[model samples]
Target chain A: MRADARDNRARIMTAADDVFGRSPSASTDDVARLAGVGIATVFRHFPTKTELLEAVLTLRLERLRERARELSGDAEPGKAFFEFFTQVVSESASKLAIAEALTAAGAVAGAEAQEAGRGMRSAFNDLLTAAQRAGAVRTDAEFPEVYALLIGASRGATAAKLDPAVRDRMLTLIYAGLKPYA
Target chain B: MRADARDNRARIMTAADDVFGRSPSASTDDVARLAGVGIATVFRHFPTKTELLEAVLTLRLERLRERARELSGDAEPGKAFFEFFTQVVSESASKLAIAEALTAAGAVAGAEAQEAGRGMRSAFNDLLTAAQRAGAVRTDAEFPEVYALLIGASRGATAAKLDPAVRDRMLTLIYAGLKPYA
Candidate 1:
């Protein structure tokens, strides 16, 4: 692809992310308008609205995976893992809404998005393992369990409509629970 | 009230619980048939199916509150609180289903049921306080935080369709997080 074409694709993805984040049912034309590109160009890039949504979801997961990769290199493994965990839970609300919107729009997660999800999980597991090896987290903490905790915390906080302070407190308690017992 | 009338009402409630548990969409006539009572009798006890659902939900919460009360009287505060927490999470799947069914059936949780829910919360708080005082739980934990944890844990487990053993392991990890760091 030409450099200009790659830029156009990236712009379309960013615009779709914004439009769908606000309204899951937004049309591809809306994304095109937001991207300041022709509808023909948007179609040229995505081919279909579902494909555009799929690309956006995949990009979101990939961004997280990239962030996790950076955090995994931090010297303080415990701090790195906990901060990544907190950040993920906090960001999950909008991401979940987007995913649900994609589902509601009849877009089955494509192979690319699913693969990105696996990449995100693997990156997270690396952080968790680092924390445990550093004696920051409980050795018994499994990836699945922590993953459920992340889902639950985000979902519960959203359902409860908790204020930031209260949600932070809850996260702190959960972090405490995940740590090795003295 | 006549003794037989009371017995018939009790029987009707039990039948409603069973029928709704199996099929949230089941008709009240089905409940009457299961109770071996006339439709008129069921109507006499609960003027509306919503009323019947309200009564059952209230009864379920009341039972948990009563159980909490009994556990509060136990000599072991930490054990009592942890056990009650686990039991509540385990049972939440069915109760939540019933609640969702009630909502789908156009039943607003009646004032009585809401009151029972508060009563249950208060009872659970007593156990939390007892556990904290006994040095089993961290003193800094607040009621709202713990409540959110309960909601998250139950909802997450259900969403994951986790097996019982896996759910228990997750619960144990949550319990560990709630405990004070030595």
Candidate 2:
């Protein structure tokens, strides 16, 4: 692609991210206006709205994977795991609207997004294994359940009238739950 | 209300519950037809989709409250609390689509629902207090945090591909977290 075309593509993606972050149902025209590009230009690069959404999610998921890799080498596995889980919760909440929109559009029906989800899950499993090996977390529980709990809590936080302090409390409880028995 | 009119209303609510249980966005006409009532009669009774949703949730919430009350009187406060929490989680998952629809339509924002939510919170608080007093749960954590964590776990269960056994294990971990320090 030409430099100018690449720039337009990047600009459209960034705008779509912003617009869909706010209103998941934002139209292609909204993305075009936000990107300061013509509708035809927007359609030229991305044939369909679903394609645009998938691209945006792909970008976000890539960033999330990068962050997970950075956290993987942290000194304390338990702390690293907790911090990574917290970050995932916060970041996932931010992108949840867009994910919902993409799912609704039937764009995420295949293994493309599934592979990304699996990558994140594997990162979490590694953290869990490290923590259990260190005797910091209980051995009885598995990774998927822990991840599911964290994800659920994140979504509840979005809906409930909770204080920031409450989130910390929730983290403490989760940490406590993960502690090994005497 | 007339006897036949009351019967029609009950039938409509039951049918709405069944359809919405399957698909939250089931059309009013579908519900009316399922109830063997004319669309005009359904409209006459409900006036709006939101009204119909509220009617269904109102019935469900009443049943939820009754269950809470029954659990409160059970032999083991801790066991009862866990059972009650599990029931809430299961119901929430099963009716999530309808709940979302009700929330979107602003039916759940009514004063009645708010009061009911507060009542449920208080009921959970009472259960937590009883369990703590019985030395079955931790005294350090607040009741609201416990409720929030359970809600979060339920939300997580909705998204994750968790097996029933894995879910049970996760709940066990949460219950362990709620226990007093050994």
Candidate 3:
């Protein structure tokens, strides 16, 4: 893609995320205006609100994957794994329904959503695997279980409107539970 | 009150709980039939199905209170507190929507539901307070926080369809996290 087109796509994605964050009912026109782009351009890129949301979810998956890649190379496996977990949990707090939303977005985004999900699983598994190898995490603690726990915790935090200190406290407690029993 | 009338009410309540447990949408006729009571009897005791459900929820709240009372008498404060948490989480796995259901049940049940909720809180707090004083729980931990955590964990367990071992695993992890950060 050309530089201007790439820039337009990035701006639209960022704007869409921001707009949608504030309200799931945000209109496409609102997204276009926030992106400083024409309505036609927004339509040309996403075609529909569901598609736009799909793209946003896809982008988030990619960002997490990138962060996991960076964390995977860290010297401190345990710390890096938990930092990544915390980041994912924090990002996922309000977006806990993203998976269901992506599913409901219809057929066009199905393959893409699964691809993003697979990418996310792969990314987190990399961090978890490394942590286990370093003997920092419980040997039997599977990525799937951790993923399930994080989903629960994120939604819990959102429902509770946790203060930052409380959020940190809860996360730390959960992380400790994830550690191998001493 | 006559013995037969009391028996009918108990039978109706037990049947209603069983019926509602399997399907929240279970009909009053079904409950009446299961209880071997006439439809008029059912209507006489509780004018609406919502009222019956409210009655069932009230019973659940009372049961929790009774359990908490029993646990409070145990010699081991930490063990009793955790035992209560585990039991509540277990019973609550599929009933996470009980509070919302009660709220939507309408005006008559509202005060009673709140009273039951308060009763549960007081009971659980007694165990929590005892545990904290014994230095078995973290000083900073509060009953409200624990309540929120259990709600999240219970829903997560339901979503995950966790087997007994895995359920125990996750619960242990969360419980460990609940322990004072050593």
In every candidate, what fraction of the native interface contacts is reproduced? 0.56, 0.70, 0.40
By summed lDDT, which 10 consecutive residues of candidate 2 chain B come out lowest? Answer: B98-107
User: Candidate 1 lDDT, tens digit per residue, A12-96?
Assistant: 9899888887677889989999999999999998898888888888887788789999999999999999998887766655445
Worst 10-residue lDDT window, candidate 1 chain B: B98-107
lDDT score for residue A164 of model 3: 60
Question: What are the DockQ scores of the candidates, in order?
Answer: 0.42, 0.62, 0.34
Q: After superposition, how far is residue B133 of candidate 2 from its true place, in Å?
A: 2.8
Q: lDDT by residue for model 3 over A104-169, one digit each (tens)?
A: 323445567668767777878988999999988988877656766765666556555566667677
By descending lDDT, how would the candidates be arranged?
1, 3, 2
**Native RMSD of candidate 1 (Å):** 5.3
- As for lDDT, the candidate ahead, 1 or 3, is 1
What are the clashing pairs of model 1? Answer: A177-B177
lDDT of 3 by residue, B37-147 (tens): 999999999999878888888887778788889899989999999998888666545554443332232344567765876777788899989998888888777665676
Q: What tens digits encode model 1's per-residue C-alpha lDDT throughout B1-182? A: 99999999899989988887666678999999999999999999999988998787777778888999999988989999999988877775544543342222223477788787778889999999999999889999999888778777776665555667777888988898788777
Off by over 4 Å in 3: A1-12, A22-50, A94-109, B1-59, B95-111, B180-182
i-RMS, each model, one decimal: 2.2, 2.1, 2.8
Residue-wise lDDT of candidate 2 within B106-181, one digit each (tens)? 3345556555555666777777788788888889889657866866666555545356666677677777888888
**Between 1 and 2, whose DockQ is larger?**
2
Give me the candidate number with maximum TM-score.
Answer: 2
